[model samples]
Target: MIPSVPTLHSERFRLRPLVRDDARALFPTLGDPQQCLYLTRPAFGSEEELWGWLAEPGWNGRTWIAEDGEGEVVARVVAVPTDDPEVEEIGYITCAHRQGEGIARECTAALLAYLLGEEGKREVIAEVDAENIASIRLLDRLGFHRSALHIAFEETHKGVCDVAIYTLSRER
Candidate 1:
């Protein structure tokens, strides 16, 4: 199993674990259809459902909540282990109201460092919906290059969608 999640830090945000109370605070954005459009799962129907997901104990990865100075959750990040010991897959979701504020970039950069340094992962990859231009741009800014190998399409709750893979190596 992955080691206990640790609190990470950035210039303007603190990345830590989610609390029960955070489910309520994040429901608005996480439950919104627009925010879940590119996700494999559909928008959560209620705060309780989102809470249940957060409460799951057998998570195969590490997760963190990016909180601003005021302690509000601005975004969530997850890094899942893959078959290759040197690699991990990552994902992030930003609160709707907090988009375009550089929170994702800063917090995710910290996450990348932790994964590559402390976690001993040599490479990190992110899989995003092909149509998610914003996320694709973010991955690019983070120095993740689009991998030639990608899913042509996958049938998910959102119907068939093209998926793209991006990767960042520790040496870079």
Candidate 2:
């Protein structure tokens, strides 16, 4: 069964479950090619396409949409269980216009607390493209250390790319 997603909050944001209307609210950012540069998927061509993708049913993870004080959707966060029951993988996409405002970092920090505390996850990991410096720095700021395992190359829509794995353990 899909686990229930609880609303999460940070000093400047409130994270809640994603809804259909979010497709419209997030399109300008999620559909931008520049914003999707280091993402696994390419930019969406239209709001309908993004909705279809967002509404697709195969994800076995918890997803949340982060909203700011004005009720604007500023980011999207997700936590997916890994092969090891004690570990969970986390990811986020910040709205293009809201980049550099600490939205992803703040919301993701809240997620880490939930996963490692309430959810009893021993570790939280994030697999990021090696070339994505911003994300690497964010992970560092969040106290995540680079894992020893290095993915030399992985083929994606962006072609062959190196992936860096970062992890934060509950004891850390």
Each prediction's TM-score versus the true structure: 0.95, 0.96
Least accurate 10 contiguous residues by lDDT in model 2 = 148-157
Each prediction's RMSD over C-alphas, in Å, is: 1.2, 1.1
Candidate 2's C-alpha runs over 4 A off are 149-151
Least lDDT summed over 10 consecutive residues: which range in candidate 1? 148-157
Native-to-model Cα distance after best TM-score fit, residue 135 in candidate 2, in Å = 0.4
Best by TM-score: 2
Highest lDDT model number: 2
